[model samples]
Target chain A: MRMSKIVRFSADVLFGAILIFGFYIILHGHLTPGGGFQGGAVVATGAALVIVAYSYEEVLHMIKKAGLMLQESAGLVMFAGVALIALGLGTTFFFNYLANSGLLFGMSVPFGPNPGELNTGGVLPLMNIAVGIEVWGGLAIVILYMLSGISKAEEA
Target chain B: MIETIIHVLVIAGLVVSAILVFHFRDLLAAALASALFSFLISLEFYILQAPDVAISQAAIGAGLTTAIFILAIRSTKRYEEDIP
Candidate 1:
């Protein structure tokens, strides 16, 4: 459907709000109920809004399918690579070795309110971020591919 | 509890929306409603403490997926024929 000015403006505003909100959820994931996946999905919703309010062609121009595919693949590779790194470090898969110490950026950040809480850890945060990026990119790409295919069919 | 009530309501909403999606004659409305249904389901997943699944659902199920479905339907001759 073609977007009118009012609809486009509304969608743009909503998309921006969701994008910011998603980042908030991702950054404070440890201290909140939200996390990487939730935040990433929220961001994807923002992209979806752009597509819906504008057009698939516009969205595709902004975020090409090839670039989105690369992003998604990179995110998956990062997650798998991290797991492999943990294995090489003599830990089980998905172990958070980096999170074991409280040092981030050479400064000691307290793990949490409690000294050794499970909630406070090494690789969990990083994993969450990776998962978020992966989900967002992967889903957006899937949507883009579907829309593009439909458009192609229409032309044919 | 309030959480329990919310969960029930969300599930009910999902079921109702799903039925509407299948039964509705208007393709766009049905798709939009289905998207809302998926969004509620995602919210339910969040309440259940599965952010990962919720994220995927919200992104894939509610977001791009629905738009793609609608666009596909639009490209078909169905919407055009119904406009007159």
Candidate 2:
């Protein structure tokens, strides 16, 4: 069931802002308060707004379930690979292997708020990104699947 | 005093919304009421100075959970059967 025009318009208007805010939270997880799960849930809420406003067929065109499934799988694989790489490097699992070592995503952050370095927090930020991707894909796919399932049930 | 008043109001709203969640015969409305309950609980978490938890609760509890409930309700009956 499609909503009123006003609802659809507002949803479209809010979607970009919500997506940006969610990514901001995800990237700044180490420096800021919100992390992967929080940011991902926020993004998923934005997708929910779109899903609620449009019909199932319209939503399918907007969000591909197969793509979401692939995204979810990729995110999980990347997260696990990132974590396991620390072990392969002869460090414990999920070690701060990149912190202050001048490797990729490695920079020293001082103790304070708003340190102003995006290239800090070592592998933590990468982990946050991986979790964010996994969560965003997982939650959005669940909503899309539920919508598709309900429409099928209605048809049968 | 102002903070205390805000806290009291949020807690009261939480109670009211929880009761409304149980009282509504319409499942969609109940899900909405639960969302309101989640929002109030999130507010309470903020009052307690846990902003991160508050954000998670507000997003997952108030937002996504409500969407999931609404979707489930779409598949089944909207209204509950009255007890004899």
Each prediction's TM-score versus the true structure:
0.76, 0.91
User: What tens digits encode model 1's per-residue C-alpha lDDT throughout B6-57?
Assistant: 9889999989998998777778888899899989988998899887687778
- Count of clashing residue pairs in every prediction: 1, 0
Which pairs clash in the backbone of model 1?
A99-A122
If you score just chain A, what TM-score does every candidate get? Answer: 0.83, 0.93
lDDT of each: 0.75, 0.88
Query: Across residues B1-84, which tens digit of lDDT does each residue of candidate 2 receive?
Result: 999899888988888988998899989899999999998898899889898999899989998888888778877899999789
lDDT per residue, candidate 1, A1-156, as tens digits? 456999889987798788888887776676566787778777887877777666667776788888878888888888898789989999898876776465641223454564333345466666777877887787777667766777677678
Interface RMSD of 2: 1.0
Off by over 4 Å in 2: A112-116, B77-81
Q: What is the lDDT of residue A43 in candidate 2?
A: 92
Candidate 1 residues lying further than 4 Å off, grouped into runs, are A105-120, B1-16, B40-59, B77-84
Candidate with best DockQ? 2
Question: Interface RMSD for each candidate model?
Answer: 2.7, 1.0
